[model samples]
Structures are given as C-alpha cells and as structure tokens.
Target: MRGFGELEAAVMEHLWAFPDGATIPQVHERMQADRDIAYTTVMSTVHNLHRKGRLTRVREGRKHRYRTTASRAEHSAELMREALGSGGDPRAVLSHFVERIDPADSRRLAELLATMEEPPR
Candidate 1:
C-alpha cells in the first residue's frame, strides 16, 4: 500500500479522531473549520479511501458511516515495516533510523525491544 495524498491525509486524520465512525458530511463540516473545502471533494476522497481498502462503511440512514480498517498507530507501524523491507541491508537501514531519532526515543525503543518476545520459527 501507499501513503495518502494531501486531502486524503486530512480526511483520514479527521476520521481517526472519530473512533466510532463518521459520515462524509460530518468529515466535510469538521474540515471546513480549518480550510475551504467542498463537500463533494470530501465525499469523493472518502469513497476512494473505501475503494483502497483503507476504510469500511456501513449504511446509516441515507449516508454511509466510514471507519478506518486499522488504527492510526497500526498504519504507522505498517509504513515503518514497509520502509524497512523496501531495499538494501535491513541492519544498515535500521542503524540509520536509530541514529536519526532522539535519545529518549532510542531508549524507549530499546526498552520495548527488550520486553518483546521473539517470534516463533
């Protein structure tokens, strides 16, 4: 899978904030508070997200309430894993990634890694 575009990202952020789910009109209304956007644009974006399998929808009266297939954190982890497997040496990529992070984050990562159980063969 690929990352979201500008408008798509905005829509996803709004949807993520609504854990229960949101309709196109609801998302469009919230987004209009920040920027000038058309309702149809929001509608199309949400529909495209559903087509991409990023979102699921259920009929709510006359509108469809949409929800993300995964949580925001899960999506971020998937992106990280995708990047890690993209190319070249995994260790080298990880080493560079570690080097770029702040000390606190590095320490936190180390702690988490230490606590994690190894996957079964």
Candidate 2:
C-alpha cells in the first residue's frame, strides 16, 4: 500500500466519486471496470470504511447503500491534521511547509493577511 491499504483507497475513491450513494454491487462493478476485485473484497472494504467513519450506510431492500460521510475536502483536511499531529509540534511542521512556499505565493499570502487584519467585514 502506498498510503492507505488498497481496499481502503479503492472504497474511498468510489465513495468520493458518488456524492449521493452506491450499493456494494455498484462499487464492485465500477472497480471491475478498472481492475477486477472480488465482490466480497468490495463488501468487506465498504464495511471497514463504515467502521472507520469514512462511510455511512443505509439499508435499501436486502442490501445496504453506502455514502461518503464527509466531503473530500473535509476528509483530506482531517488526514493532513492526523499526519501532522503524528509528528511533533504542528506549528513546527507547518512552519517547514510555510518556508517552502513559492515567493509569489508568499507575497500573495502576505497581501491576504494584511487585508484580513483590516477592521470590518
């Protein structure tokens, strides 16, 4: 696994792709279009996602429909926070990232900060 387990990433991708929701069979079919994972693999992956709080399920007939519990941006931010927290001080970690910001971007950030500091909305 590069970052997350193969099943986890695959399941998350499917959940993020469909904002509404999808059943296990739907996800399995989609995955089949790409690489051919077993149906049970998809089912258990969705179950694990549910347990991880990355997905929520609703019953539909005899099967359960799964949907993303959080938006992609929300999930990414949480993961970033967790990754940073895993190290030492977040400030120190962020400071390293800040130092590497492109010069043009740094200037833009300063301009935005100055505007934000101004009183009034």
Candidate 3:
C-alpha cells in the first residue's frame, strides 16, 4: 500500500477481495459503484499493473479474468524491503514506522520477525 499508487492499490484491493477473480468490466463495475471512474480508466490501470507484475490474468472466453499476483502481506513486505534496501536511512525509516505502531503491535511484529529469523536447511 505504501509504495503503490492510488489506482494500483485500489486494483490490488479489488483483486484481493475477489478471490474468484473477475474481468475488467466486473472490476470496473464494482469500483465504479464507489467512485466516478471510467471503464477505460480501470482497464488501463489494470493493464499497467499487470505489466508491473502486480496482476495475473487468465483468458475466459473473450475476456480476461484478473487477480492479484501476490498476497497483500507479501506485496507490502516486498515494497518495505525495497525501500529499506535502497541505500537510504533504513534505521530512521524503521524508527519512524515503529513510532507509529501501538506497543502491542510492535511486540507482535518483533515476535513475527524473530520467528522468521530461524535458519532453514
């Protein structure tokens, strides 16, 4: 969500929610209910995201059924890692992010990272 542009995030959210996946029209219809967006606009957004490796689609008759290529957590983690590994001040960024979390959430994130640090053969 942090690195994704507005339309990209919205498209991802739609795919994540629609587990069965959907065609451009379906996604456009669902999203248009909330916002005054054009079909071509949604279609363009979905195509651009697909080109960015954020979406995958299967051919269904004459239409393509689109879905999220990765889970929300997986995408977010990849974005976070890219940001941290960009040679910037990761420590400062992390400190800022940690400061925004509740104490309980900070502990839970620490525990999750600790659990993930185990070596695997």
* 1-118: candidate 3 lDDT, tens digit per residue: 3467898788778888898888999989889888999999999999998898778899999999998878888988888788777747989889888999999999999999988998
- 1 versus 3: better TM-score goes to: 1
Best first by lDDT, ranked: 1, 3, 2
Residue by residue across 31-113, what tens digits does model 2's lDDT show?
Answer: 99999789998888888888877778899999988998777777777877787888699899878867999989788978998
Q: Which residue pairs clash within candidate 1?
A: none
Clashing pairs in 3: none
Residue-by-residue lDDT tens digits, candidate 1, 1-121: 6789999899999999998999999999999999999999999999999999999999989999999998899999999999999958999999999999999999999988977866756
* Model 2: residue 63 alpha-carbon error in angstroms: 1.6
TM-score of each: 0.94, 0.77, 0.82
How far residue 3's Cα lies from its native spot in candidate 1, in Å, is 0.7
Better of 1 and 2 by lDDT: 1
Q: How close is candidate 1 to the true structure, as a TM-score?
A: 0.94
Model 3 spans > 4 angstroms off: 117-121
How close to the true structure is residue 59 of candidate 3, measured as C-alpha lDDT?
99
Return the top candidate by lDDT.
Answer: 1
Question: Root-mean-square deviation of each candidate, in angstroms?
Answer: 2.2, 3.5, 2.5
Best by TM-score: 1
